[model samples]
Target chain A: MELENSGRESVLQIALLGGVYNNYLALEATLQDASQRGCDEIYCLGDLGAFGPYPDRVFPLLDQYNVTCVQGNYDDSIGNGLDNCQCGYTDPRDNHFAQLSFDYTLANTSSGNRAYLRQLPKEIRLERYGLEILLCHGSPRRINEFLWESATSTQFLEYLGKQHQADIIVGTHTGIKWLRQLADQRWFCNSGVVGRPENDGATNVWYTILDIQTGHHGSSKRRALENVSWRHVPIHYDYRRLACEMEQEAIPTEFIETIRSGWWTTCLEVLPGKERRRGRF
Target chain B: MTTPKVSLTHLDQLWFQVAGTLCNLTCHHCFISCSPKNDSFGFLSLDQVRKHLDDSLIAGVKEYYFTGGEPFLNAEFVDILCLTLEYGPATVLTNGTVLKEEWVERLRKAESLSQYGLEFRVSIDGFSPESNDPIRGNGTFGRAMDGVLRLVDAGFLPIITAARTWPMEQDAEILDRFVQMLRDSGYAQPRLKILPTLQMGAEEQRTHGYLDSERLTDEMLTDFDFSQLVCDHSRIVTDRGVHVCPILIESPDSRLGETLSAACDDFPLSHGACMTCYQFGAICSNPSGQAYRVKSDEHGT
Candidate 1:
């Protein structure tokens, strides 16, 4: 029943999180949830600060959980002392809020933490269970790209898979989770973000769990499709407390509204029509 | 003495002047001056589109866009879009006055069946008829709103694209009113795209054309991200030939070649419209594809 002809283990379970955005409570909840589910590995796909309060609180948790981290656009900005978050928002209102968050995060973050972020890799590549997995904050090509589920095409994903030589390409940054299966069992997964509720009317945030196992095709061929399953695991954390902290820190009230109502209040101008319509602005 | 040349980085967006220099409305700000009875450029047959679609796949085109005097004016517009949705995501830019319910219904079905998105960008200049009628035409705002509602009824969220005709200070107020108008018209979640008016074509007469001094010098692109320019990432396929970019289709120098492969040559930053693209990056793309502004320190390489 095992497809370990390559002289390696043929099963792996990994938990993937993107855009932490300083939501230490959600990160803690996600860590505990992943551990309880017997995840073999857990990874944070960058963006350690923004929106929420207490940027330093996230560092200790990452150390405790031994989560591998990749550099995100926010991380790059904070680490390099860049002028803005490079979130690609065009509206003046969106830019205003983004600047406030970026300035606050930069001012609050310790120099050590900024250095840690600077040293993080733009992409993390791993091979396990006969699958070549690539983890990145956005697409493999750009750090700030937004690959929204509705706007991105399967052919485009396939092109990414081919270009990167990845059987599974996982990314985040759009703050929503989605997955598409390409030909020959190739897959693209947006692990979503724990920073905020995905514009849906739900308080819980989401992460992705990929369970890769031996071939299930019941065939003798070694090239058979591997049993790769993806699940969007929702993490219910103390969002109300986070909202209070945001208010106390004098953060934009728009951000707090998103936390309380599970509807995005800012940085919405970049959303495509399909994705934008899914949310209550 | 040579103009700056921008090479094709990748054919990320492939455009079809499907309806050519033809449109239902003759808005004053129409950059290409697309209007009724202007058949300088002809509609691309479905066969022509099919050939280019096949060619685009090899070139690694990420998305497809259709435009015209009006794409829907072409009898095979729906068929062309349905076929394009099979290759990748497709966006159609229209005047919004001429849309049929049956076409929307069929297009909706096609979009649902495909993994790619089918975006309809409806062009209307102003929030009300009183404001829009002078620029777009008499009684045009109502028709466009009706088209938007029909699209909503068909479960399609069309992006309402408008050129910035009002004063720059009133942008926020204008956009807010536009959103409210769409909401009142049954599009509960209206998606809006605000475009900077290109001072070319009819716009040159309405407002003023680009000043003589408004040109990109070699020094201007030093630290500038040329990728922000649509010519760097996109090319349009027309019945005449493959053009450099959608905005410059009327220019004699805009035509690069007859084939996409032959059209990958570098383009000169010579035209006044190039200045518009330089000022506002990726004006033709949907908001999702628009380029980010370069940091202040990164400007003027």
Candidate 2:
């Protein structure tokens, strides 16, 4: 079930990541954690450049760590020389900040890295111990769609899984990580990003570790997921260092505040009430 | 010239005209012309809602919406909302005049128990009674503001939905006053949604009817994002049957079918209101669905 990103479908332990947003320090931290934890594969689900500082810093690490990348809305914008990041914010304030971040990331990213982004696949499929996994930037349908945990319904997630024919469908444009078990063994997950702290007033950004296992039923060896689970791993990177770098780069103080404090400052309008209320913004 | 047909790409939003053409207020701009005396449509019972919620799941409905002249007019509204939460997230459109503390509390409890959020889109026409009362009704501003505070006190962020009765240039000034009013009333995290006026039903009389030139032509839809139209992803379940959209329920041709699956078909964007939807997307949807703004040209489709 592998899509353009790779030829092989076989995978056991995966460190799923998303919303890189130019935070190379956190990306470095994530790579170290994934390697230390014996992850078989590392995937960065896109938005490789945004928010932090020195957009080109993210490219070398993706190459160095062998992280499979997918094209996110931000990546698509910068790659094709689009005006906005296509982050899908209608509010004037949200649009203003989004434009600023897009301009900065677009200006800073090198041509070589832009080529890499332009070539990334929109989605990737994986077969893990007989389970079909679909990895997308947002949902399986649209790139910039925000599938918030509260606003999104269980039936809808179930519908997405059935429509896409994947046992597990994971996306990460919202920057908030959550996992929900659908009917039967099917699951939907948001592999939260290391780009910034999840709006929850904590400096530790997050990622997901999807573990699949097989057990021997007496007298038979089957490739079913006897034990399949995912945990949102918090990556405690050197945010103070990242904050100083952002200051040096003259990134918006609003963004630097989100890096220092876990609460999101800009892009507040896009959030649903339940998600919005959780943030101090 | 033939009008462009909008196909049902997906049923992202499944709306219910729960209260039917009945409202506590007789807003002059009501597209459906619902009022206390008017009963062109009736209330939907809890059983009807239960059945539809199940059908919507099979139809791949992402979210559920309940609207009316004002949704709270129906006696079983709260019960209907509670049962809807069992299936998916629910958003109810209300005048904010007739909501009781008990209903709000129960809804708050139902929302807390479910993984899905319960959103209340309070239709407050203007910032003040001087502004809102003339449109919604006299003294409606006081009552709706009271309803807003009550929702805020009960830990609900009711999106203060106001229909734009004034000019576009007045948006900044109006929004400023609205934010100030909400914050002054102790709603700290105020969420606001502004809507464009649709010329139909009672509103057709208030404002002049759409000219023939205002209709959407087939060529206009070329390279146009069909997803911008609600009919592409949404259908309203009325007591009569499923309609193309919440705005076009009054049109005889808008009724697609009685069942959710049957309603998933192509529709003619021939009505004047279709032009309104073309101008403003996220019409009946919550803020989350507003990926693009009213000025669709601001962001590329």
Candidate 3:
């Protein structure tokens, strides 16, 4: 559905939605769908390389789609010549597979992808949307921070108040789609990773459509932020292919299964599986 | 009842740190500062909890609750709830990050099978990550909401709990925003609970522990109702043993005598958090819609 208030003014829109791993099948379909939905412009949310097998194929497609890309936590670490993924996600008690997956993300990121990643900004600000939309790999303040939609409004307001002025804020890192309105007149949204399926145990990539709709409520035309509509739409994608590609990439069976099942197995802390072996996490 | 050196109250509710010290994600403000490495507490095996069930029944306990670094992190969480439901109504406090469809299904099944009702309280610090991530870690906000959605899908409505880090005057404005956000995330009927932060555990170290002034004294009890505290009527069952109350489960003195029956003696509300309970009665008894009725008189009215 269209953003509620949009009657005529062009809606400022942006979406990476999901990471486009080499699973071109899902990527192609998702890109087609997103492009058709009247998105003002498409933004790619990071995780360009590492994990899935089709980096060669996927990179080209993203370029073809002309998606504006940001460097993910993984993209930055690998590009920096660091052996770690630098995901900033710490599970003190990781099981085996998680360790393997983290290591794999580090080992697999190619130099070409790394170089591209190193130049990526932690965030990009958009002024055209009539809103200060900051695009980043993670939270506006912290690249590794995970902003869940369930967080308290006060907490959201706390972070928003500290950052640059923006009517709407967007980030990726979390690989989940959620939109929240903060008390200090800011909107926070996360576009789930395309390369990685969101942890809902469902194989769906998510994105939001921000269509400009006219506001009928309190239309004094005095409220600078009045006439905008933002709608978050989550769509299902084929995780089976991503899982298959992950297995082929030697991304660890548990990681593949986690992606396939859309469920979180035990943390890397609780169950460290064979970092080199194929098994349950 | 003989009053010991400290005010003694009968156990009113049975609470357990079922998830132990393991959390799927670590938040900066966790009172216990639980994380992947912090197993200061261990998971409660099914057998350990079963033993306490018998003791609770014997002691005439009325309600039960399960909390942790993240309760859902426990492999046997579903099983634990299923079993606990047979004895008394149960509530599970969680970060709501790791809830998958399968787990939600299992919870729904357990709720339908048990005579007593089951409730879930999902904690979200800020309405979004910008507000939450600094406290809870990155990507946590999205994951937690996914957990809430799973609860809704399971046919169980969850109570959304938030710690008021903002000024008290901002409460109404903050709540309205929270309610709107919850509705957007598939929780049409959101139950909200706002709590003041406990300055102990990880929090104390994060900022400093209780100022010497924060502690409670005998004079503080002059107008206080002990019944307001969960310890008055509650007991906690853990792998080690059954404790006097949920609030005191972390304190060594609150451990009681181990088994639910043996732990029946009076408990001392010496912790600073106890003062908070004394001031704001029943902060944790499922605030509004209690799934099961517990006998409140044991803790003291």
Candidate 4:
């Protein structure tokens, strides 16, 4: 019956990748959207915690929805066993602040949650709605792969070639929602980071719904992904409340300040200072 | 009122990944997360590199560069460098951990043979092993120094590139420490290039990546210094194709086109790192020493 429903309806397949830490309101809204849209399945790509005020609130919701999530570097960092977040990025300075984010996240996550995070796979390959899709936190080659729209087509093709099977490679971690097709082989899309803005300075987080269909475009049996739409779903949450919680959790002052500043220190390109609100501060 | 004409030019620099995605030591913060097991980007054959060099020569390219998991890891690195020097002044960017005495001698000999200069840029994250080893790998500092010393012995003054993971205020002390280390290693005038880490790749996990706000829109380039941007003039030739700039090789859009001629179009100002390049002109080139220099006490102090 479920299989029949998928065929009859242009069932939109949706997967939630990492960077969606603890914005329960956003998560709930997405889940609600999924339920309303007659979406077949919803998957959570890890990172489930960090930077947000609530890890406890976010994890159970994921389970409740049966969202398939893989452990991101932050998820591991929050698990308490790993010496570092193992985010794959390194600081020559061996920064105290970077390590602090890991500490606070670990202190907040529960044992049961840690076990669940520990069990998540690095990459997942799925044939959803008859389309070959590769779902990963970063790239298929490595976990925490930062595949941005700014990357070269050749670089995308290289990863696409490595897949040998995927027609579409979807990733998270770049906080920016991007969708692009590379020749006939594959389409690389990032679900964008739910923890922050979508790099466009918009406060809305990103999520995608792909309506897959079996069609013959040329002289071939091709499963085409149609109506691939992404929305920067905006949810107004009490950020001050989240910031205060982060501060109370003894997360680094910088980490807390990041929540306040709404600026990621690494990229150094994005994040406009909210001069409009400066006088209020 | 008239808008200034924005003209795109031929790619002046051609960067090639000689040894592909396989590096000798896996740096914890490698932007591409390149390692021994990672062969997603394969080493370019000498013939392949020569083909790109031929393309560059025809296109009148101004510079050439070789980068890799570790460029020296390519067995034909010397041959590739020799081939590159024939066309233009070449720079081989390496972590400087695996420089062999024989390889250094060959490089010097090749430089002498060509009218164009051959430069070696070493990747040195920190001045000390304690600081560098934890991030690069254990015993990497000592090995890197050996490589640097060998280049010095061979009469090739290598430019040491250190990614500034430290605060901006602390740059003077860091540069001083770095210069002192280089002097102690016996290079009379130590050339250093301080780089800011692009928070992508393996480094993304080591730290948070670019924020949602950290991206470049097309209009931002209007007031921005696009001339200094590597993508403005340089193109990288990988095993598969030519890329816009060396920094954005991992990006699918980084590939400008297959050849230098094909890449000679106005590239859209994309990537958050392009903002960094725009903020500071010509992050890849400099007038004093090479393309870029570290914050020196002479300037910063």
Best by TM-score: 2
Cα-lDDT of candidate 3: 0.61
lDDT of 3 at A267: 38
Instruction: Give per-model TM-scores.
Output: 0.92, 0.94, 0.49, 0.49
| Candidate 1 ranges with C-alpha deviation above 4 Å | A1-10, A129-131, A214-227, B291-301
For model 4 the interface RMSD, in Å, equals 17.4
Residue A29 C-alpha lDDT in model 2: 97
Model 4 scores a C-alpha lDDT of: 0.63
Task: Report how far residue B71 has shifted in candidate 2, in Å.
Answer: 0.9
> Which regions of candidate 2 are displaced past 4 Å?
A1-11, A215-223, B291-301
Across A37-126, the per-residue lDDT of candidate 2 in tens digits comes to 778899989899889999998988988989998788888888877888876665677777888889999999899888888888888999
C-alpha lDDT of residue B32 in model 1: 83
DockQ of each: 0.37, 0.39, 0.01, 0.01
lDDT tens readout by residue for model 2, B258-278: 888788788998888899998
lDDT of 4 by residue, A173-209 (tens): 6566666665554577777666754434334455766
- The residue-by-residue lDDT of candidate 3 on A204-241, one tens digit each, is 65566655433443433224355445666655677777
DockQ of 3: 0.01
Higher-ranked by DockQ: 2 or 3: 2
What order do you get sorting by lDDT, best first? 1, 2, 4, 3
Each model's iRMS: 3.8, 4.2, 20.0, 17.4
